[model samples]
Target: EEEEEEEEEEEEEEEEEEEEEEEEEEEEEEEEEEEEEEEEEEEEEEEEEGEEEEEEEEEEEEEEEEEEEEECLEYINFCYKLVISVCCERSVVVVPHKDTSGVTRHVMRGEKCWCCASQRHFRCHTTCHARSLQP
Candidate 1:
């Protein structure tokens, strides 16, 4: 009977050691899973931020294109009007004027000559001098 009691005690000790090892393995697995979940969340947030930045860049480009288109249209309209006036023999003159109020960059003055009517932004003094000189 003494020998039997000793064997039983030894078996109980072995079982307790195996249970402790299994508990340790389970704890390690839980920690690994938590780490993986946190990493995934971080990756998702980074992707979302990248997408937002791209969208903003695209919007800015589109707005710039729109502004360019409007400016081109305005320039075209001015050119068309100039052509009509020239064809009708209506003289147009462009004279440089200082902006007293910081508003207009240049102001027109006097009736435009035939040469000025044909040329765009024609300087009257230079062209007049060239044309009027004895050839």
Candidate 2:
């Protein structure tokens, strides 16, 4: 009877050890799952931040384009006024003349002249004269 009791006690101890090991494995698995979840959440937040930054950059680019368009319209109006003043009121000759400076002073046949010359008045005068001849 004593021997049987000793065997039973040994078996109980073995079972307890197995149960403890299983609990430890379950805890480890839970910890790993929690860590994976945290990592995923961090990645999602980063993606959202990147998207917001991209949106802001796009908005800024759009605003810059609008400002450039407005400036272009204003320049066109100024050029139109110059054409009217020199062609109609001044009645200057619509010919290209090169002055002391090497820069050519007239609009090309098919090309637009930005009036890039050292002398502003002469440049506007020639550009306006050329513009008058256009249909």
How much lDDT does each candidate structure score?
0.58, 0.63
How many clashes (backbone N, Cα, C below 3 Å) per candidate? Answer: 0, 0
lDDT of 1 by residue, 7-126 (tens): 999999999999999999999999999999999999999999999999999999999999987865665455444444443463553333222343423323343433345443444333
Among these predicted structures, which one has the highest TM-score? 2
TM-score of 2: 0.64
Candidate 2 residues 1-135, lDDT tens each?
Answer: 999999999999999999999999999999999999999999999999999999999999999999987865665565566555555554542344333353536543323434343334443444444443321
C-alpha RMSD of each candidate structure in angstroms:
9.2, 7.9
